[model samples]
Target: MKALVLAGGSGTRLRPITHTSAKQLVPVANKPVLFFGLEAIAECGIQDVGIIVGETAAEIMAAVGDGSAHGLRVTYIQQEQPLGLAHAVLIARDFLGDDDFVMYLGDNFIVGGIGGQVADFTASRPAAQILLTHVPNPCDFGVAELDEAGRVIALEEKPAKPKSDFALVGVYLFSAAVHEAVRAVQPSWRGELEITDAIQWLIDQGQDVRSTVIDGYWKDTGNVTDMLEVNRSVLETVEPVVLGEVDTDSELVGRVSVGEGARISGSRIVGPVMIGDGTEVTGSYVGPSTSIGDDCVIRDSEIEFSIVLPHSSILGVRRIEASLIGRRVEVTPCLRVPATHRLVLGDHSKVQISS
Candidate 1:
């Protein structure tokens, strides 16, 4: 079976960062989120892979060239516009051919990988197998309703009145039978061809539709809040390794991985923190669950539970927590008096206040 990875999405929720980079390329523990999915697919011994890319196709291609680096031969399939998940399958019909394939969302992060799920799919050979997880807000995701026997009987896309709390995870396993289902469905009210509709179509035709509720950690890293949460989750498992220089005055605590060329001086880094290659942390308190990406500079700033992307700088900022800083961005101290009560900020732009 081949693998079809969907790397195309506008990522409007990620805003300014997505404006500069693809959401799939966002780093988790200094590695692109897409890399995790590709690695998982490789582990399942699926070599022939097709990546569905949108406007940022060039960048995706450049990062994942021949896919030989990941032990897979990749074929790039361009989608002029992101019509829907089903639309992606519709366009990749040629690449997918007659082989069963796994459809993965590039921005989604599923801990423990999909090797087991792929193995089960290959064995059971269901028409379509979807991974489901209980979510707090089912309305934000495609939900599935189960019968008395716990079989998926109905599927709804972002339903106002969800019948079940199970939200569809981003990974999907589909046999060749899904081609007809994709063709049978029309666009939703959002004018996009949702994959949920395709699955519902298969159910309507009495095709075997299966659901596996994942017990492991899973997250759709589409927005900033979820992205930071995933970053923290991944960092929790980090094994401490110091490939870079740590000054005598500096103290490194649990599960910290300082990459080569990174220098830490006169600072204390708590456990579960990652300092990417060439990053410098001096006289700062780098707390837990923080990932400082490559070539970043953190000086006199106390950062915790944050994701600082590559080449960014945090200088003299007293504190930053639960924040997502984009690449090449700078956060500096503001020298002014502060008097704030309530500020109504608009959508999708940076806001700074003097303090």
Candidate 2:
């Protein structure tokens, strides 16, 4: 079976960062989020893969190139616009012809890889199989309803009132039967061809639709908050290795990976932090769960649980936490006037002045 990875979203939720870069390319533990998904797909023994890309197609192409770097032959399928998940399948019909394929969202992070799920599908060859996880906010994701026998009965896309808490995870396994289902399903009210609708169509036709409820860690890193959280999660698995230069004044603690050419001096680095190649951290507190991208400069700043993109500089900032800094961005101390309160007194206002 081939693999179809969707890497084509505008990622409006990520704002300024997405404006400059593709959301899928955002790093988690100094590795592009999309790379993780590709690695997982590769581990499943799938060699031929198709990546769906949108407006940021050039950027994605530049990063992924021939896919040989990831041990796979990748075919780039341009989608013009991110109409929807099913829309991707519609356009990729030629590349995915006559073969069962796995559809994976590039920005989704699944703690345990999809090797098991792929193995199960390859063994049983289900008409359609979807990974599901119980989420508190079912309305934020495509949800599924299952029968008493634990079989999937229905699916909805971002329903106002969900029938179940099981939200569809980003990984999906589909047989050749889904090609017909995608053609038969109509666009939803949102004017996009949602994949959930295609799966629902199969269910209505009495086709085998399977759901695997996973309790493992899963996250859709479409927004900044989720991105930072995923970064923290991935860093937990880092193996401490210092391949760079560290001064006598600097101290490394816990599981920190300092890349080649990186230099840390007069600084204290907490564990589970990754400093990318050529990055320099001096006289700063690089706390746990932070991934500083390549060539970044962190001086006289204290950052923890944050992601600093490549070539960015954070200088003279006392504290920064839980932030997602974009590439080549410079953050410096504000050299402005002192703070002063300015307010207009109302008719019945009571005011007191500091001596």
Candidate 3:
């Protein structure tokens, strides 16, 4: 079996960050989310993989290369535009010829991996098998309506009034029969060919469209909020290992991983935190759920529940939390002027001054 990983999308939700970088390349626990998915796919023993890339194709190519690192031979399939999931499959027909394949969204983070699901699909050979999870807002996702018998009754893409809370997760398993289904479906009102529509086509043809509701952690790390949440989740399982130097003046508490050549001096670091290689933390309070990237410098500052990217520096800043700082950023104290309230008063305007 082969794998088709969809890494093409205009990540508008991530804004300035996405403007500079691909959303799938965003780090969770100092590692790219796309790498995690690729590793999972490799673990499932799928060696022939095809990655669908768009505008940020160069970056993805540079990072993944031959995919030998993940035990897979990757073939890059360029999709000029991210039309839709079904469109991706349409373009990858040659690469996925005749073989059953798994489609994984590049930015999705599914804890516990997809090995079990792959095993189950290989055993039964379902026409289409989808992973479903209960999300708070079903309207923002492709939702599934299941019958009392736990059979997939209908699928809707971003419905206004969702029939169920079960949103389709990014991982999907399909047999060779799905190619016919994709060919039979038409594009939705959104102009793009929706994958949900193709799956619905299978249902209409009496094909076995199966679904499994995953209870474990799953997140679509397309935006900042989910990215931070995934980061926090991945960090929870981190085993503390101190590979670098920690001065006598520095104190480490709880679970922390200090990478090679990283120096911590005159600082108090509380864990569930990871300090990357060659980083320096001095006279700072590094709190939980924070992953500081390699070669960063954190001096005389306090940060928690944040991700500081590689080569960034936070010096003499009072506090930072629940934030995402990009690479090569610098955060320092700004010169302060005398405290004063200056304002222009309009006619009949009443204002209260802080004295």
Candidate 4:
């Protein structure tokens, strides 16, 4: 079986950042989010892979060239527009051929790899198998209804009235049987060929459709909140290693990975955290679940649960938490505002003030 990875969405929700960079290339723990999916596919020993790319194809190609880096021979399929997941598959019919394949969304983060799922798909060889997870907002996602035997009976693409809370995860396994389904289905109101609709078509044709309900962690890192959360989730598994410089005045706590050329002095670092190469943290507090990218500076400041992109600076900024700072950005203390009302704030406190 081969793998098809979709890396061609215009991430509107992550504007400004996605405006400049491809969403799939956004870093989680200093590595591109798309790389995780590629690595997972490699773990399944799928030697051949196809990546779907859109407007940001150049950037994605530059980063993942030839795919030998992941031990897979990759073919880049160009999608002229950000149509839909099914559209991506439709355009890659030549690359996919008659082989059973797994479709993975590049920007989605799954805590564990999809090795088991791929193995199961290859063994059972179902017409189609979808990964499902119970989500609170089922209406916001393509949902599935299961039968008494836990087989997928029906599917809906973001229904106003959901049949179940089983929202489809970004991973899907399909045999060549899906080619007919994709062609048989019509475009939705959104004017795109949704994969959910094609899968529903297969079900309507009495093909064996199955679902795997995973209780594991999964998130579509499409927006800032989800990106930061996924970063934190990946950081949790890092082995504590300091390949950089840590001065005697500073302290390291918990699981922290400091890359080469990074220097820490007169500061305290609390981990599950990642500090990229050539970064300098002095007289500051780098708190838990934070990722500071390469060549950044943190001086006389405090940061926690935030992702500071490469070449950014946090200087004299007393506090920053739960933020997604972009590359080459400079963050300094707000000198434009003067303290009129000063009060102590507990952690996670909320204050409403006019800007």
lDDT (Cα atoms) of all candidates against the true structure:
0.89, 0.89, 0.89, 0.88
The per-residue C-alpha lDDT of model 2 at residue 294 equals 96
Q: Model 3, 106: alpha-carbon shift in Å?
A: 0.5
Could you tell me which residue pairs clash in candidate 4? none
By TM-score, the best candidate is: 1
- Lowest-sum lDDT 10-residue window in model 2: 341-350
Per-residue lDDT tens digits for candidate 3, residues 1-355, read: 9999999897887766777788899888999999999999999989999999999999999999999999999999999987899999999999999999999999999999999999999999989999999999999999999999999999999999999999999999999988998888888898888999999999999999999999999999988788889999999999999999999999999889999999999999998999999999999999999999999999988888888778888787766778777777766666542243222111122233222
lDDT, candidate 4, 1-355, per-residue tens: 9999999988887776777789898888999999999999998889899999999999999999999999989999999988888988899999999999999999988878898888888888889999999999999899999988898988889999999999999999999999999888888998999999999999989898888888899998988889889999999999999999999999999999999999999999999999999999999999888998999988988888888778877777666777777777766554444333222222122333221
Q: Give one digit per residue, the lDDT tens place, for model 1 in 104-125.
A: 9999999999998999999999
Query: Could you give candidate 2's per-residue lDDT for residues 99-187 as a string of tens digits?
Result: 99999999999998999999999999989999999999999999999989999989999999999999999999999999998899888
Q: Residue 9 deviation, candidate 2, in Å?
A: 1.4
RMSD per candidate (Å) reads 2.8, 7.0, 6.8, 4.7
Candidate 2 residue pairs that clash: none
Q: Which stretches of candidate 1 lie over 4 Å from their true place?
A: 336-355
